[model samples]
Target: MKIGLYFGTFNPIHIGHLTIANHLAEHSDLDQVWFVVTPQSPFKKKSTLLDDHQRLEMVYRATKDYTKLRPSDIEFGLKQPNYTIDTLTYLEEKFPEYEFSLIMGEDNLKSFHKWKNYELILNNHNIYVYPRLSKGKIETQFNDHPKIHHVDAPIMELSSTFIRKSIKAGKNIRPMLPEHVWEYVDEMNFYK
Candidate 1:
């Protein structure tokens, strides 16, 4: 089995996120796209993040109907300050029969070198990168890696930060998220 881990904060799961997962699952060789809900991301500020379990629940509710898409709290069980390298190592050992690959955006690709043990991650795992508004060509810089492939995952111009701001401003985020997710967000006061 081949699995692509799509790790993110997912403060509230949105339609844009689901579109990309569906796109990858339907078009790529990957059998499933696991939304690895991070307990905390090393790169992003913790203050900007919501509670991990809450975010995971939102993800679960949003993806409940799609078997190819699932939510995970794998990082909660890992050491503090989750690192992609460490998670990859743990997953590889625990699920030896399944091949794991990373799914990320081109925006993240620019800072790829900053990750812990980036060289090991590059050598051992395959990466599927999607486009973002970020500039520059990823292939020009990372094309040397044998296990890397660029994907065009459907993305909205909007981001989680923007969505939060919209909610705070009493703006409608109807297009930014699916109905169920919006209902959950309103009910739980997430991003409030």
Candidate 2:
């Protein structure tokens, strides 16, 4: 199976997140798109993040109906401040038959070289980068990389940060999130 790994905190799985996964599954060569919910990110603040289990549940709820998409708890047991290279190595060992690709935003690509073992990641796995609303252009160095493919996945300029802010402000965020996710958030009174 060819799986595209879309990693994020998912603070709460929203429509924008789903849109990219859906687009990749439908338009790309991938057979499955796994949303690998990050428990903690080295680049993000831990205080602003919700409980890992709750965030994972939201991803499961949001993707339950999509056959091509599935929620992954792969990072839950991994060490904190998870790095992409380590996850990729573990996944390859466990699922030897599966071909894994990295799915990321253009903004992330701008700083791809800074990631740990970035060269190894590019050498072993294909990177499907989608356009994002960013201030910088993708570096020319990545233009000729055979493993890198530029995908037209819609970058909804929507961030979990923005959604969380809206929820705290007592605004209706239903349109921005998956119905199941919104319901779970409402029921739990999350972000308030």
- Each candidate's number of clashing pairs is 0, 0
Superposed model 1: Cα runs more than 4 Å off: 134-140
Q: Could you list the CA RMSD of all candidates, in the order they appear?
A: 1.6, 1.2
The CA lDDT at 177 in model 1 is 85
Cα misplacement distance, residue 97 of candidate 2 (Å): 0.9
Candidate 1 residue-wise lDDT, 109-128, digit = tens: 87788888988888888899
In angstroms, how far off is 38's CA in candidate 1?
Answer: 0.9
List candidate 2 stretches off by more than 4 Å: 135-137
- After TM-score superposition, what is the CA distance of residue 26 in candidate 1 from its true location, in Å? 0.8
Number of the top lDDT candidate = 2
RMSD of 2: 1.2
Which candidate gets the maximum TM-score versus the true structure?
A: 2
Model 1 lDDT, full chain set: 0.84
